[model samples]
Target: MAEKIYAGVKVQVDQEGYLIDTNQWTKEIAKEIAKEEGFELTETHFAIIKFIREKVAKGEALTLRSIGKSGATDIKGFYQLFPGAPLKKATKCAGVPKPSSCI
Candidate 1:
């Protein structure tokens, strides 16, 4: 874990830049992270981010198929939204830890 400032708030993040303490997450922090990753978050993006965060809080496995099933968006749409590595980007923007399924 490493300390960093996001949205003017100090928080802990992992080596991959995912938030280590989910409690420190805020919409402003999500915006900062997404912007840093070259993504401009939209309402659709926020929906996906919230969905991923909820699933993670429940200890559910994070995966493309799982996100697709979330009804926030289909798998194909997810790919379109996040491009190359949708899951990785989504998790980061959601202020969740990097999914073990990633990397």
Candidate 2:
């Protein structure tokens, strides 16, 4: 059996085994996604930060600007992709001691 899932949590397990739900979209699940994506959990913060930084950098280099300049569209995608790292806590997870490239 498995615990009841609420919101977008797609997985369920209760001393039995793993059962993945296709419709789920939660932080803990996202964390698992990143892990499956070849990123270590302990460094997930760094992973997301770097991922954001890279994507932002790529966007900026072409336009001779920065990630902060992308406007609404960019912001929306960022939120969707890294939903686990909420806007409020992204900074701490990024682990950029003092902010480095505006990700």
The candidate scoring highest on lDDT is 1
The TM-score between candidate 2 and the true structure equals 0.25
Q: What does the lDDT read for residue 66 in candidate 2?
A: 32
The local distance difference test score of each candidate is 0.89, 0.40
Error of 1 at 89 (Å): 0.8
* Colliding pairs, model 1: none
lDDT of 2 by residue, 1-103 (tens): 5654433553554332223332243446545544443443444344555554455444432221332344422555445544653442342233212233433
Which 10-residue window in model 1 sums to the lowest lDDT? 94-103
lDDT of residue 51 for candidate 1: 94
Candidate 2 residue pairs that clash: none
Cα TM-score per model: 0.92, 0.25
